[model samples]
Target: MYLVMRKCDDGFRWLETDLGLDNLDLFVADGVLVGHLAWWSAPQRANVSTGDGAISCETSEIFPSRGICREKTKRGVAPSSPDCAMANLPHGGVLKDLYLRDAHKKDALAEEALRLPAVVLTERQLCDLELILNGGFSPLEGFLNQKDYESVVQSIHLSNGLIWSIPINLDVSSEQIVALGIKTGARIALRDPRDDIPLSILTVEDVYRPNKAKEAELVFGANDPAHPAVSYLHNQTKEFYVGGNVEAIRSPSHYDYVSNRYTPTELRSHFKKLDWTRVVAFQTRNPMHRAHRELTVRAARARKAHLLIHPVVGMTKPGDIDHYTRVRVYQALMPKYPNGMAELSLLPLAMRMGGPREAIWHALIRKNHGVTHFIIGRDHAGPGKNSQGKDFYGPYEAQELVEKYKDEIGVEIVPFQMVTYCPDSDEYMPIDEVPKGTTTLDISGTELRRRLRLGLPIPAWFSYPEVVAVLRQAYPPRLQQGFTVFITGLHASGKNSVAHALQVSLNQQGTRPVSLLLGETIRSELSSELGFSKRERDINVQRIAFVAGELTKAGAAVVASMVAPYEEAREQARSTVEKFGGFYLVHVATPLEECEKHDREGIYKRARAGKISGFTGIDDPYEVPKRPNLVVDWSKQSVSQIVHEVVLMLEQDGYLGSS
Candidate 1:
């Protein structure tokens, strides 16, 4: 007989009056049965007792939270409650979408049975009770025939579907069990099957229990952000943690970061309520300096819009200053902003350094956050270099690409030229405005850093001394020592060979240089999982650029050979590296026919046979170097001859010295 134990609060009164078995010495062999039964729906109490009828037993009990259970009588005579009302206990609702069997109801019920005051079984003890119970014997017969009381307790705790059961030997301390329940976030309760009484229930508390959808419904109402539910659900994905023992919450997107608990719909409503006719978004990884501030202030004033200074507060490339510090710097400058025109919010976005693609993603994200205009600077998502030590994309490419997607993305792309001071004009002017004839008083961030490190004064016209001091404090001089030599050309255009030759030559000349060969190095250094798609290739190039920047910081000259066919990718690389060390473009001008002839690897030959698509020269368009610092024609020169020319170019550019 499968005797199921159910706990209810109503069983205590019935057992005390109808059965008259409350005070009987209820002993079965060496074990005794004890019950602290109470009614399920009504408040009627019964005390622990040993009944004396056909068996003899002794009972001992203790209650710390409430001292000793008391027998209480109501309405003069004993309360005659219906058994059906008392015994018909409702099961907890079925849990849906059970990812694991361990989360099933049967398992929950088995765990619940162990905490009963009358039983008190450990997980091991519960298993033994199942064996005895399945043998089809009465409680007294089972006890007499059972191997040991401890074994019985262990059996019951392990039994499937057994919600509660009486245990022979209650060895586990209530404190220990309660502590376990608390730690595991599981519910604990004491229950009696015969009396249908439940006592001292404990339940697990939900951590991420906030009603996000409901909150969103209340806040957003009808005005929901685009792909609202999908966006929130995507944010709910988690990462494996604690040796895959548990999952941890992922950082939310930029939209979710500012809105906090409010749903996307509610956030939209909140945005609509604001008297913001025009919303301009400024995207930045660094704190605003004078030039940056000036640019944004002017842009905001021009459009008569409110400036939303949304700074990225997510993972960035290595060696970048922490986001917290950048945010603090912005806070210090907040007071200087015109009243009621500027707003600041942290945007949580993982930087792809994707140059063009990144620019598009940034604009779309700002649009989702209710911004109408987005600032797109040169080289927006620009990652430095590929594992093979090659630049993936150009700086200006990001801006141009974003412009292409502007109408589709539904956000205005604000283009701005590089801001610099013109000494002849005695005023700050965009780089484009500076006359070619006038001596350009251009100072790079790298040069400024070097000057500050050497205790030299930075010209006040170029930047505020306070800003220079802050930059110095943030980045010391030693970290600003490297430069990148970016090589661009078609595949098999002697780009990689020339880069390698340059490395060998630089080393022979007593210079320790790092060389990044785009294709070869990427296959070896980065994870094999990363493929060679246009996007991946772009990412690889950015990573290479980042590494080159680091090497430059270490005072090492970096030689990188990459098929940077696009002008935009090169521009971005130049902008990024020139910010710290310096950038020089070396165009290896090998004609399509000559490049195909030297395609010893048969890459070009395969393209001719239609075996490959997007072949740099044959199939895809290869943008020729419009203006490069040094251009080498492989058709007109030998490998050694080209190497000598490279050395000459480096010496002329101040990368090397004349002997």
Candidate 2:
């Protein structure tokens, strides 16, 4: 008779044995003869085989071997490797003898259950096992009844780093076992159960856990107290501490900006000690500019509040300027601020652009940071659209949302109108303040970037030359440098034609370019798993932007033609390009009637006949440009004529070589 045993971390140990005996006689004292058991005590030392061989025990500091004598002396203790105790077992044949003492033969027959090795279980499985073990069912009975025992065992082995046993009849090779382990999410350590010999090893899978501290260190400097996220967390913890929120005591150390220590709670607390009667927090994604400075200074002076210039230092919308670069810009402009009246702090927050919801969240967070008042600019907390490709909320919606909760949230919401410069007064004024009929400068950040890329000068009154220079230095060259041309208009507005025409002209001019026709190309190119909803449209636009940014970065000009009607989607596209190259807003201004007449694709016809829902210009709203760099009237101009004008515009903007 032969018995099989598994190798343990210490050495070879008995697991499931094939030794046979009658149940009643095996339990009776001195009643029956059990089968011969030839198992290696230390798998590393002995070889198991049908043929006889002399076994020798060799002990060394480096590697120890087990023999019959050692096994007899160390009855149940497993052999240990010099390094790791859980060293894998060796494979191949080993020889040993099974002997039973004459006086203990009956006891050995009754103690057959003790020969089984303990099985390791995972948390979930352990819970199941406990249920069974606590008078629910016998272990052997439960094991036989279980349907998912193998999968459960595999899960346990994978999570807690345990070895598994393969049946001898399976004829499975070490490589096959390893493959199975990997497929089952368990790591494989190749070794023979009979001998502690290692062959190969592999890890099962990668686990992802968010490392907040490491993220903080990377975004903020290793020890920066002024990091807005750190400061906000610290201030929050301190305020909570006064309220006897014991959880605040467990707050982690902040990345200190000043003393360069991992812990900046002391510095943050010191900054909070200032007795500020009125605290005004300025929220911005971009660095300080002349207009921003004017706004903050004026607001501070008017309310007699201490200005807290808080800039978001977290993951912003893709293609927006990097927070680090923005921070450096702020540092450069700090000296220009009035002393004692202004204070600067970094706030690390992932902006959801929830528009109204975001505004409310921002105010609540500021309240936690001990801010009494917050500046709610146009389009606060605004993520552009809903699932239907419609503007979910307006620019003022965020302000109103915050205002609705202000009294309950304990934060004052100050709404600021859009600020623009008055060339006549040589002073900054809100858009409403300017005379009704007076032509507004009307340039947007997108247009500003486009002009800057074209080597055009931005007005000194709108932005400081120094600041503009910094921006130019940070951004790539516009025009000749590959950038995104976002064309937006109604269906049948010649968006695709204009894009193709631009592409053909660019290619003829020896420029490699790619044209992204949203409806025709992108819709089909995206995975079928994506649904056709407003959210899906937004995602499609984002995907297009990402691809365009990639192409632009690789020096290929991109002509992206999409009906990106919503302001937020367009803004996201503009931002994505601004990160790497310039972004141009080309509004294909074709009249609704003209677009309907040119509905060669029959889309507008279908839309008007109630065959289509949420069609732009028919049912859905197309956000007309608040400000576009170049407006092409597709209704009047032919595709060729439009292409020619665009090329000339590009040439004048320095996007193309001199013709």
Candidate 3:
């Protein structure tokens, strides 16, 4: 049985006795073929007869193959190219951006047509969807399923041998799958978590639990928590992986910076209109300073290419400057670049900080956007340090890796030229180019943060005044901002006493709104239906975190006391609350015997009498905090003394008064 695959646009027609290398099992692209070939671009069916061994397709004119080398099936989206990709480099036949054409725009489903079951997207998932629809991840129609994910993670290659370093799949909790009653072959809608709008439909292809440890080691190069990506894999992601192709019914609706968030097709069109054929792209999570501006301009001039100032506005490192602030900084710094030399755009990618692998992944992404060159700095995409207090990757590892695959990646790697300010010359010069005897001045990132916290003057030579002003506005001195004080201990372990006393004290001072989330009150109101099971307890803690977060964002000083017995749950609470303000975890390390004896409610008596099920200190376990800001044992001290210690912590952390 012979399978025939034919394309006519560029007189490309070749079919062997059977299919081979590609996932389609019918088409081969290994460059070693012993198959008979034929030119099948004839006008009519009778023109090429059975004797000539040619098969006719339904369409009158078949175009050149311009898409992922997929498993060619009878029913699939027809291969087509976008106008924006017409000027693609010869070697990189990157598939066209899917969002460019008029047809795909019509694929959005009406609200009335959407089914009952929908998965509300998280911030990270939203970032992924934006890229898939915008064609930043070209040739990937949807999230990866089991086959694709295993291949991508284990080998950094798709089943068809495409280099894809990271696994980008939609994850859901096992509870969610059961709640939705999802089956093997069901169509589910992906909804925006922010607004609940139906964005796309995913046809289920596989449902399986992944080996998370394996994934952490293979994909992130470490299973340690010091790596941000590894921590996210264990803490943020759910249990099950759902895989399927997406039919984009609508792009994500955004209310902020609409103009700056450009898709590949839009950028490609703009470049075409500007007559910018050779473009160099710069990617950053931080605000652009004077040195960065100088480096990028010099790189573009060196390559004779126009500049694209593309910054990631999606989730970056945990504690990164909020995108709203960074975008403002970017806008302010734009005028510093030579006029007509640069254009600004935003990339909504949740960075993995994979160092070397991520650097290559970034290059491939830029190549898809019609960029001919990309800038790679020392330790590109590096995620700080490991638990051993050592850099995860070598300084030049990213540059070296990208250069190793330069030919296949299609984008030229531009090593970052470290520019240092020279007082004598009054100009920025490369570090190596400077005279040996010349003195150089520099400021570290930690130093910059210290300066911002204290409202110190930032040197104009280091950054533009406009950028510094914007940063100062976002990171106001810690004394004027909001913060959270989370206290956890066993039941009736003086947690409530301390929290209530702390609340009253802060209110007496009355500099900020003092809010309290006590355990009993929340259980009666927010979590009345929840039991003492581990899952239910976790849910209760999260509910408290949500309320605390909103209050903290409004410049309030929030004090929460609960039986947050799990280390993981407490960590989650910290992550949620810290996004808006300071989060200080205080473990009431009162000994179990002391806590039981100090209980005035007779709760310990009931637990010993077997009336209370799943008692925390009796049957269930309590994970001790290895490092809490303060550990108060009222048995050895007074409640007044404990409260005094807590207040001191607040004052020292720059939340109470000017530090």
Candidate 4:
């Protein structure tokens, strides 16, 4: 389900899903509750209001496009001329939030009054819905049904023949569908998985399992999980896809950078109000450096267009710079742009990282925002590495594809020439434009990341000091503050012993507070009531992760030892703990025979005699970690030996001092 919700020139949008909830509430999508709104708790709000108050949202997944219908539209130009299209090219179909906001105003309390049965959303689904509602994914009124899904996957075009690369489908597990008792005609409420407050209502149309191999081969050009999108496909994505039209109650709520977030309609109006007739958009998911500045400025000057520094605030590649850090960098670099030459805005578009096709998709989106041109760079939106340790797309592949579809895409494609700073001249120039034998300075993204991790200086020639400062703040040196030592193994695998020994060893260092969440202790203290059902087990693991994460965030060293048998559960724990600091996963890969031999309590004997059901080592599977930071077999090595190795790991990673 895709719905309409976005920040605008006027107000905040929130669809209240429950009467039991107060002013400030959380969002739930895909079993994960994310983001909390303080604005609601605070008296002052962002914009236009219903009778009670202007609702401010704190959302992890923010959404879609808005109002450009009032502006004139022209081919290869801003909508300024008298003979331009009658209704903002209406071909770029977007539902205006203004309409929903107005309608809600008439019935101020209507949204909260109509209580619907809610369906929780995943993070990806939240991103998809936001774009759909905002018209960033224009011409798409809803998630892809079977026809459109197949057409887009097989041909990189929507069923309507529009060149669309990514398939936007609402996937759910068969278990989820059955649990909800969903049917083809059901009208279900879509809520955030973070804190399950409803965001939209979907009238289900089609439920189908897609052709996974075909989708992977055609759309991603690879079927390996090493590709982030492909990994998401196999791991995070569910079995069934639900397609239908959505009635978005409100935009996904966000609590950060409220001023810079604008709807497409708001942007178009801003451009119109400023008489920005020739607008060129530069889309980025990374911090803009001097080279970036040179390239964008040159592109704008060439077309005599105003610059719109539009960066994505939605989901990007997994390990890329966070939006908060990048946004601060953009703000610091704003004054460097020639006054009145550029404006900065955030886009809520979830990139598929489809490279070539994504470039076309991005260009089409800019056109819908009423821009005359878009800057297309090398490997635009490229998903970094394949399993073979090579780029998924050729360096110039995006530019080539966009060039082929430039006219049809409507936005003029501004090719990004490699801009580098010359040491002798002390000026930036396109790589091809430099005189013969001119020395140039450059820092590749990978190199920058490597240097940043080591706290090395990023020279002025490569980036602005302000931008570098922002990056450094976000990515401090590895030797600083906090970390999590997550030890996972079979039920009787000496993980508890290792955890206690590690805690003692860390304490001996006399550095930071060390917390230990050993298995039996946690089971007794935190999860006394929870049984061994899959859901209960996962919950127990998550609780341990939560406690450990909070401690880690507060700059404490935490050692968590758990059975954590499920791969999904372990990954979830790691994701949670790492947000605060370094997460080292140690697998106690001691053999099952060894664990049973060390049982001592006759627990394994009971399981073998069928006195106990669903025993982990006997009936339930223990998914061995494919790649853990350290693996210790207690059957061979002593606890002291394993502890030494773990401390060595900490020393190597700069968590522990070599002294």
Candidate 5:
């Protein structure tokens, strides 16, 4: 009996054998005999051909081949070389490995890098550079030049007509452009910001300013500050972008997740060794849970493919769980899957939260990593909500966008089906499959955080105990966590006295260590050279916020008192400190006359006499708190009374227990 299998447009081929051959099976990859497929059971013969050595089997399932580089199967093209034995071909047909592995060549480049002007890479830029060097960002030799950048921003395609959604440009200040003499044809050293170690030397091809508004509007769907990427572009990104091709001296160093960090070439080789030709890649920046596991397993099973749990380890959403904790969660989830069915790997990707556009970008990245299929879930890479609290994108917008270009991308899009737990069956099922009026349970991210904060029980069916244990360790109950009380007002508005009283009260309560960040004391110790200009004050307040955040993360109660007149600076401080712990902004609202009257040091008098220029509330303005948690007037409230009120607020927020 002879069996025939033909490649299908969906990147899978059918298996066929005569009923006469019950015990044996054949494995064919691109019409070439590779091995024996012994895993399938006997199937009934659907059709028989006597003259032609071919028979059709009853099994219509699309089974993946064991040893074949699945290229664009719809194109019916065969692998070009023997080297393409397994794994999917990288996007754009080539895996550009830019790493100079030869010892002598690397040494020469490293020495040459010393002579060129260096641009220290930001965290996000380092992530991009690493991928470029390793070919995870295949076909991208280096940062995008002006032509390609404009094309990508406008049409989600490179200037060459290749689909490249996100623009990868080396952003720099105008000062750096002049100081480093950066322009077309100039060479500059790209160094790691952490250690100043040279990683690559780049030959600049184009230097230009990007139209951020146009880019944000077209690429991100909105130019809203609430979108993290838009906010970053307007607030943080430099003025000029330098584009160039880089010759790598060395890849970026990563001490953690060493075993799981695989370059594109290495990953393809590993997949080939495992004889896995069809891979389904799961992308996540958040920690995995039972729902995620079910979704991925179902997708893989439906596709008859192995699973790759690829999580982003670089900058994610600002408040997302740290990669270390997320990695641990993923590790905990590995054993839950059937053995040898899944693998975990870290992708050092700096996510732009670009919603639909980012979905295509992720698909291309996975395709470059030899992934045949990618899972695009609801609101994939979404940036939460806009300033008006409406979702930035529809739930299925990412899936629809990915679906529109899946064939062109050469990576099948597996739309993630939302799963919920059914206690009646003690299992998870897709939300659509669950019958109406049936009891179902699900946890939202907000609810999970609330439960974790309040030390509430998380049902075992929702997540594994091992995973919950890791999360609990990372996020202790609110009572056990620390908090910061930030006081801001005009000078001598009893800010220091209130801060001191709060510190003493907290210390006496003894739930955690207490830290006091008094403005004058900080000025002498940490900001002696910083004058009281608006800019200097912002810097001083930012330094105070940094220390307070550190203390809060260390499980300490911090009371920071500063004249922080500008609301923007105060808001910045709140954002910084709140990442680690709770932040309470206490506005000391004593009248300006009352403050001047209580100024024992005559600083206000000196400011009135023009001795102190830019004295807040005297020469400079003090923007009143727009959203203070607690407001106290020293003329109406005593220090003890204010401390008691602050303590009550903390207690109510569950930051205090038996204290």
Candidate 6:
């Protein structure tokens, strides 16, 4: 006999089950059942008795936060909850379509919007608003108020007891709060940042400064900057959260993929029209390939359900492929699918990459779109790695969490496994199902990107020609692509000289156009008004990075050399430039004493004499990069040698080829 523990409102109760030990370990590990009476044998408020290797809870015991065990049938299988069986129902038993469809109401709301203080939505906020207005984030009428926000962060549930894992909040800067006089009961117009079009009017319910550290730790599982979402939470998000009810005047306009943009109601209606009662949704932010196709097809066939290709078109992890390219790839794959068995739609979701929490959130969103099952793959919605280069979540953590909450989410979890191509059979099969010693083949994402950069041929077995064509157009050979070489050092550390030398060397190649952005040149032209404070220096570096990013995106080589002392500012520059193309950080590690000795401009002399206050390497600090692509002590090495080393580094990284 095994002991079954289930969480109740007061605390917990235990029931006996006749399941064998063989099934208990795997079942408990899957988070479906809890056993091993030794762990819970201790008495709490009331006496706990143990007999026949069974532990019983008499009074109240708090359930473990990892998971709550479900009651099992006689056969030891957890029965699907009644609410989960009602697959057609939306969260909260209602599809809250908040868009104002009536012409008169829309006109009146639009007119009133012109009079209220307007808050232009950022791209991420706009994505959140679109989902909220369309019921894709149903049971949520608007941005979550402080109560619901705290509720979600603390318990992964709303104050109303709905299982909403992620918080939907309108984060605004403190300046906005002061500028707009935002406060409780104040109605503000939510305008689109693109065209200043009023999309909704929100009635402010709460304006509060969120505990961002707590939210980052609880919702995202950590406050480490290595996780993209955690980094964004602390770096990009605003200081205050404005939560309220939003009455939509219209939906955000999407000119691209007009036919593929489906609101939750519209998609559900389309599925009904197609007589698709059991639809399984596949969520992706990347381009789908052969292995993906095989996995989705196998999952759909196994479940006997129709397929929906739902891809996120909003903010994903930084440095991800642009949505335009990914969407094109998805559109190209439509013809590859069996015509009536599958359909495609776009979800404008600002993904937080919250891994396990995000997996449950994705499932709920799909459920709102009438999906009966969601295909959750390993590390679903995971932000790639942490600062230590370790995965933030276990590979199967998302699958396990989603399985634990699948009943309440009302969407069946389809756990995805790695599928490998078997050359012997000329077919793809799950890795576990392939016979031992069978020869198998696969192309990793890293290898695929390497092939794309080097202009090497991608095997036909890995991806279709049409899809490859799209990817190739977007990611051209390194010879045709752009790159940025960011050089940073002390004030007189020869960074500018090295940058100029590198520019000349690259220009001599005649492979790409080269632009030089020297620190003094940028200071004279772009940031003359900024001072030498830490904040001002960061702003100046960001300005240089922005220009470099634009030039790189336009297919030009950018050499930005600056006395960017702070490690954070340098990293910010790298992040900015890398979004477009290659970013090589070259640290001129010329010693401060050597730089002071050279003292070309006498700036170091002034710093020593206190003529220049807050000067780097004097009063302020120069935080050296822990891991730069290349390092050069220019006091010892000549500019030509440094430039050659930089070029060689670039060539080795596939950003450039031998010339």
| Superposition TM-score, candidate 3 onto the true structure | 0.82
lDDT of each: 0.50, 0.51, 0.77, 0.74, 0.82, 0.81
lDDT over C-alpha atoms for residue 362 of model 1:
68
The residue-by-residue lDDT of candidate 5 on 69-165, one tens digit each, is 2332332322222332545656665555666222226778899999999999999999999999877776687899998899999888887667788
* lDDT assessment of candidate 2: 0.51
Backbone clashes, each candidate? 61, 32, 4, 25, 0, 0
Rate residue 621 of model 5 by lDDT. Answer: 98
Ranking by lDDT: 5, 6, 3, 4, 2, 1
- TM-scores of all models? 0.35, 0.40, 0.82, 0.78, 0.87, 0.82
Considering lDDT, which of the candidate structures 1 and 3 is the better prediction for this target? 3
Query: lDDT by residue for model 3 over 166-232, one digit each (tens)?
Result: 7888999988899986667878888888888877777788887888999989887789899999898
Tens digits of per-residue lDDT for model 4, 30-82? 11111223223333333422224433222222222121121122222111222
Best-matching candidate per TM-score: 5
How high a TM-score does candidate 2 get? 0.40
lDDT tens readout by residue for model 2, 1-659? 22223334454322222334322111111111121123332334433211122222233111122111222231221122111111111110011001211122434422431332212222222222221222111111112111222322232111112111110001222344333532323333323232332212223232122233442343222323333333433332111000000000011123544332211122123334555547778888876677788777877777778877777764454446787668767766666688777777765455544455556556644543445678998876444444456554676766776676555445677787677777767777777777887655546878876776667777777776667777777664654477677888877788889998888888887855655545558877764556646777778878888888888877677888888778888787877876676678889999999888887779888888999888878888888977687888887888998888777777776678842
lDDT of 5: 0.82
How big is the positional error of residue 80 in model 2, measured in Å on the Cα after superposition?
60
Instruction: Record all residue pairs in model 6 with backbone atoms less than 3 Å apart, i.e. clashing.
Output: none
